[model samples]
Target chain A: MKTTDNASASLAEQSNDEYSVRITGFWSGRSELIVPALVFILAGFLTYGTATMKVMGTSVPGPQFFPTIVCVLLFLMAIIHTIQILRTRRFPHEDSEGQNADFSTDLLSDLADTENEAIYVPTARPSVTGKRKAYSDWKTLGMVAGAVAAFILALPVLGWILSAAGLFWVVCRALGSKRPLFDLSVAILFSSAIQLAFNAGLGLNLPSGFLEGLI
Target chain B: MESLSLLMEGFSQALTPMNLLWVVIGAVLGTAVGVLPGLGSAMAVALLLPITFSLEPTAAFIMFAGVYFGGLFGDSTSGILLNTPGNSSAIASTFEGHRMALDGRAAKALATAAMGAFIGGLIATTVVVFFAPVLVKMATAFGPAEYFALAVFAFLAISSVVSDSVVKGLMSLGLGLVLALVGVDGPSGTARYTLGMPELFDGMSIVVITVGLLALGEVLHIASRIHRDETAVRVESKGRPRLDLSDIRRAMPAWLRGTAFGVPFGVIPAGGSEVPTFMAYGLEKKLAARNGDTDFGTTGSIRGVAAPEAAANATAGTAMGALLALGLPTSATAAIMLAAFQQYGMQPGPLLFERSGPMVWTLLASLFIGLVILLVLNMQFAVLWAKLLLIPRHYLYAGITVLSVLGVYAISSSIVDLWILLGVGLLGFMMRRYKFPLAPVLIAVILGPLAETELRRALTVSQGDLSILIDSPVTIVLYGLLAITLVITGIQHLRHSKTARSQALKFDTDKLGV
Candidate 1:
């Protein structure tokens, strides 16, 4: 037990060092402001552009007016915050020597080094040398995205039951469920119970799709 | 005497078999969800909201109260056993609790936490029973402008104080306000941000946003980390947990201290249990240190577990008072309960106290009863709850996601609603990832219309006299409290930054082998 504990502790220590290096490499002070700012800008522009359209009737204000104001505010705030972050140049906690690593210069130097050091490209899998994988687990992301897409596409035609079951199965499988039959049954039971509870028990009119008459 | 008589009448109503059954069911379900990591009372209530449409107002509220109290009990179980807090309030409990578990005193820790919860909950409920009438009298005197100011206070206090960064918190609030701006303009009937979608005329349902953001968003976040090799270590207990006379004596002081810390914070508009729990823990730690009980970190200090647990439960009761009396929810769970009240067309405010005095009194009475129920239940079932950790994460989160999607669709039968859920889910994910607080966004959306309508109505009534806002003593006090809270929070932030810098320097010195 002691030996195993020691081995696990060493492994964890090594992984912690790797994680810290990676996090410090990517998560610069400016990146925090830059990423959120870009997202807000994109979302703000979309909201503003959509709000600009005309809608009939009630003359209180156009549909776009409030959203436009919000978008403009968001854009202005993001820009101001980003500029403030840039002016600070470095986080408060960094060592003076570390602060001298200009962010843009570091990025450019790293890219150039990578280009020079290019060799036999590694496959996107666990290495035979037993090194840990460097890339994200894309399969899990795909599974979640697929489940969402299936629900959106199937909800209209296949209705709640089929679409819900499909989404649940996809997600469960992604999470490492191997018992397809048992998991599927569990999903169906849950979905049916919810549907009945809302429709019959609560007097809600949930969609029945093609099975509307049969139910 | 009149209030007592009214409460007796309320007990007569609440004691009915149907209401009793609903409360029990709600409590059981609430505890179950609360015990599950990442599943909270807010998500539970939000999921059950569609089903509440058919129930009577009194019964629905009874069930909601049961769920709220049950969550308080349930969250502590996770904190004590796994060190993964089911709620933010339980985070402080984990510091001492996980230490106790490591010391092979898990059962003792669990027992003390349960006892402390009962004591705190009982005291808080009694305070509510006695003090709610006075609060109602004060709350009733406020006009539209005062209410509007109160709403602004709630928004700013929650956004700035609850989150790690004020900017991100304000950004989340701005996002929520933008979402609330959708649908028709109430004053002029003009479409705002609906984008020609007739289905959005009623605006996005709070239910959809809540379920998508909290339940579905959590499912996604959990999935992202599922394949990670790291898992929590489980401790095996040698025997059943029992409380000795010494344990009881040690815990009693901490319970009282925690209650003192919790009740006032709960009454405030911030509506979070974290502050009270931390304050209680800090106080206990200081007292223990002064008494030369620095060994509390090694040997399980009953005070360490008791204080945070008591604060967690005590805050639950005070939060209810804030909700029922002020119609303002300080937490996500409270927000969902507010939605449930609205669903039954029963607004919770000063009028509620006047019109439903008996009901409110009985509800307060049931809290005392609920505390007893939770204590009995937790003591008997601590082991059973610990076993829940063995359940596969995949099955649990997947099931929650499926239920959320179905619940949203069932509410309105609109595909547009599903789209809104997806959109909100993405927004919630981003907010969580970026450390932006989600509670303020929900509060802003829930109260946005009320603020706007009240502001407009007050202006018309005052004939554009802005001084009408501060015309009443009540409004003046409310604004005064808001100003003090802002100043205090700013000072606290400055202190925190200074402490963090010193701590960082200490770490650097240690790293240099000095």
Candidate 2:
């Protein structure tokens, strides 16, 4: 529990750190402002969408009524968040060593070094005691997202067993599993076992894909 | 005397050979899943819900009781063994339980946790058996306005008091409300946010969101950190785990006190076991200090392990009572259980007891049976369960990922649900990454529609006059509690900031003096 807490705590602190560094073509520490900005945009969109919702002639509130209330509240929160980000950026910390700036530059250097590898190499990083590093492995996260996307696209075509196996294999490899052959075998075996249990034993209809005739 | 006779009838029904087998299977499976980090009783019940479609309602609920008890019992096992709590409920247990494990008292720690859970659950269940009718009577008295106030109180308590950042917590709550508004309006019968997709007409499925957020999101979050080797503290129990006389004497009062703190939390919609466990841990720590036992946060205090584990299971048991009596689910697991009842065309309330009297009593009886089964299984197999951590992290995570996808796909058999699952999984991952507490989101999703419906009902009764909301004494009291909680949290926040400033100043002055 402490480990998970620290894991999240460090991510929060890392974003705080990111809020103090300069990204190219943006204001100082502006990279971390993206999520809040996106939230603001979403709030605007929701508010507009709620406005366009058709109201029924009913005694009580319309369907658009509750959504409009929530959208306004969301908009208020997003504005507050935006203001907070702006305030933090306006008042830069007056540290002598520029530690956060140095760390961000070092992070960028590492990112540049790993441009070809497609995975973040964490070996050369300094071990900061008492604080876990943020989840900075964006490439791995992207691969995971890609795996799920592929799974969704392939489920209808390749069937539950094959698509699920493909998902397992992709996720395992993306998470740095070294044994491809072993992972492949386990993935196939695991998915197949689920297929047999759910489809054969439980009599649930799992899509057979091209194996409809073969199986 | 009438209740006792009904309980006996329930026992007779639950003690059947097939039901007993189901109980054992549910207990073992629940424990196995609960020992895995990030999965709790809620997810275990959610995954098992589809299978129960084939079974009799009584037998199915009996199995659910086993799963619920076993999950609470096994959750603390991982917290003690690896310092990785199976769920938020076990967070407090990991504080001193892991230290106890590291100090070569792994067996003693396990014994303390299991015993505490047994005593707490047993007592809480008894409390339920005696007090459920009274609770049902109280629940019957609650009007829609009062229910709305209670929902507001729950939302405020969870969003403002439970989270590290009130803004983030409220943001999560808002997001859940937005998601909840996806379907057609219940009262007005108007389509608001379905966006022309017929699939969205029923709103988002709780199972998909939960599995996506808790299970898959956790997998993704951990995957991003997979480069680092997890430094798990593996301490095996050397022999049969047993609580000595002194251990038992020391833990008994703490367990009772913890149960006292946990029971009321169950009645209220205070989210889940996390809050009570922490409160129990804090209370026990202070009591230990008062008792001149200073070996806390260091040498591993038995009171620490006892209090939190007891409080967690106590909350679990009483939450069931609240669910059964009030038809109100205070936690995510209880919410899923409510959905299970609904699947069988049963609504759990005063009417449920009158309608399905035998099933209700049997379900309550099976909770006691499940508690005993869990105690025996966990006490004897503490060391064996610790070996579950020895599975390679990669395979374990990969396998869980497979199960997660399979579970979501099997439910409703909709590819659209899978897409929603993936989207929600990413949302959950981002929330975790950004340090937004997931509980508020979950609680809001589960409670949003109820809040909306109750509010509308209250308004309809008063012909859209908003003043009717606060007309009732129950509504006023709930709103007063919400206000007081907010003020207390505000004062605490101010004090925290002041202390932080003073500490920073003192550090600077000391450095200059040096």
lDDT of 1 at A198: 64
Model 1: per-residue lDDT, tens digit, B1-514? 6656766677777788888787788788778887887788888888888767677777777887788888878877777777666676676676678778878888888888888888888888777776777778878887898888888888777777555556666666677777777777677576666667899888889899889878887776566556743455667644666898988887888899999988887777664777677778777777887899964767667788899889878888887887888887766677788887777677889998878777787787666666777787777777777777788888888888887887787687777888888778866655554445788778878887787677667766777677887887777887898888778766766665576557645543333234
> Model 2: per-residue lDDT, tens digit, B45-154?
76677656667888888888888888888888888877777766776777788889888898898889989889889988988998898888888898888878877777
Best-fitting candidate, measured by lDDT? 2
Model 1 share of native interface contacts: 0.22
DockQ of 1: 0.15
Q: Which candidate should be chosen as best, given DockQ against the real structure? A: 2
Candidate 1 Cα errors over 4 Å, as ranges: A1-35, A38-73, A84-138, A196-208, A211-215, B462-472, B491-514
Q: Could you give candidate 1's per-residue lDDT for residues A1-215 as a string of tens digits?
A: 01132333343465432111112232343445744566576566547656564555543333444456557656665666566455432232211111111011122122122222211111122212333342224567568756886798787787677778788888999988989999999888877776787667777765666776787
Colliding residue pairs in candidate 1: A51-A64, A63-B192
Which one wins on TM-score?
A: 2
